[model samples]
Target: MPQPPIPVAVLTGFLGAGKTTLLNFLLKDPFLADAAVIINEFGDVGIDHLLVERSDENVVEMASGCLCCTIRGDLIDTMHDLLARRGRGEIKAFNRIIIETTGLADPAPVLHAVMSDPGLLATCRLEGVITVVDAFNGMATLDAHAEAVKQVAVADRIVLTKVDLLEGREGEDMLFAIIARLRKLNPAARLLTTHRNEATAERLFTMGLFDPTKKTPDVQNWLAAEAYATGEKRGRRHAHHGHHHHDHHHDVSRHDEHIRSFSFTEANAISPQGLELFLELLRSYHGANMLRMKGIVKLADDPSSPVVLHGVQHVFHPPVRLAAWPDADHRTRLVFIVKDIEKPMIEGLFKAFTDQISGGADAFTDTTLSLNR
Candidate 1:
């Protein structure tokens, strides 16, 4: 019998951000007693896995160059082996999985593997991304490292470590400053302030509907359509991130440093044909610019039902139409995190497709999307 897809949550943070510490803490929980852990350390000497206290059998370590680069093929093979063993009942049955990426690694490549691999996609589904930030070093790291910025921008949740080190009113003020910067960078991710070893697995794995315990994921939580909506009103850019890049020269890798995230909402229903054409055009022309695209859309074919959309780069998961809207708000909303995409270009594409809106919408800033061919 085919099993239900298992949810896999990623644990990523900049170096010295307490990612391993958090993992060590979560593993202590009775809730994660059945969880399978895959640790990827980006060094020749992969000792992080050894430091983690686990029963040996369920924990996996990939200590090669990095999951983002050299060891990708091995990572996929490892997934297959784990699934095969689980099916044979050769190991304990884990209800979920947690993948810990090295501090220096970019998560996009791992995410792309999960999204694009048909074999893995069949058995596993992405629950969410949990990024740990070194409270003491996060600001400096972000300023100095592109990987750190991308880590924060792409996460569903952000966890800060070493808050215990900051002291007095000075510490309080500095903490606020760090959080302010974080919100500006990725407004959608939930920011939590907890002492080390205190966050339960429950709080960390809240990746929308994928939880299964809940009938439907809080759509607002995953998409944060309102945050992007606010950014548009105030004038801002798009931000979103993981996974190993399939190709360095591919358009997706070109402008990763300047990635931004924002969203759009349409009151009028969009024609299905128009939506399809718009997406195709966006993927064909500016797919490289798009890091992640997610939305709850009101389609002309099914005005009462809203469609769910999610994609990385040019690859999109099949659209899912809900029986009814989760709330009274029946408007169409799309949240985008892209490297160099502009709101005007997407708005123009939508306008060209359907009579959804009569006029083009405004962008926080103007950008010309060079549509070659």
Candidate 2:
């Protein structure tokens, strides 16, 4: 028997970019009827899943702080489990997978995972990456959030949403400037506009990586188009990498914590239980301060395919699996942008998540190893 094909598409943009709204519209269509939806939110209270109306069996939402940062391992695991169930006749065959990133997320790492994983690449094809931009506050967000800028820069398709909500001359010009900036960031991406997110599923799916005629996304070309290609030309520049360069006193007075970001990656595959525990720990510590976390995770049990995770303040979306590997190298990569969290702390916690700490290392020792259901 032939293996079922899986098409993965990422929906990403800055906070309040109407990503959820667009998703709501997309999922309601008949075309998306059987697609498995994964929502990664970064908040203590995961309400987005509640907001999204879908067939319960087909949707999974991660309630951890950020899916991309904390639950990428979980994402891959979930996808594998989904496939196993499909093999067992547990659920209807899902031909497509849609991953929605947290608003304040950078899509590069997610794309890297999908385009680089080996197991995922064989069974699944990358359809395309769709970025939704809020016509109302997009310009201001682009200037403020580095993640938003990267989201626009790496999109295969840019969808302008909520244009009808904009009012007055300032709003109109802001919309135009937002589009102009997008053109500079990504010249080849197909552009689409939605006044109220009134777009057909066919139009949204057009940018997918798997052209029925051309089976796979050219891995080399896709990675090259993004910043990772010109890693040298881009420089070792991070939005929050140079904390020492900023005037701490002035920044505090001005409440510059609003503009914050961080990135981290690990060399080993994380245990599914370890990933969940790490997310719980993050929520217990930095839930309110976390803005976004997105990453690709390699699971110790399943190295062939990497899982994709996304999150927004306190709310985690679900993790999605790619069919086969995108490339040969397999390292768990995650990028996080937090409001006021320190980089060292983030790194320390990540290590703690994957490290084999002694059971007696802490006062409370309850790491039985369970995952997000």
Per-model TM-score versus the true fold = 0.79, 0.51
For model 2, what is the alpha-carbon lDDT of residue 334? 64
Model 1, CA-based lDDT: 0.70
Model 1 Cα lDDT, one tens digit per residue, 109-189: 777767678888788878888999988777778877878887887888899888988899878866875785677667788
Q: List candidate 2 segments past 4 Å from native.
A: 1-4, 41-73, 196-198, 213-373
lDDT of all the models against the reference?
0.70, 0.60
TM-score of 2: 0.51
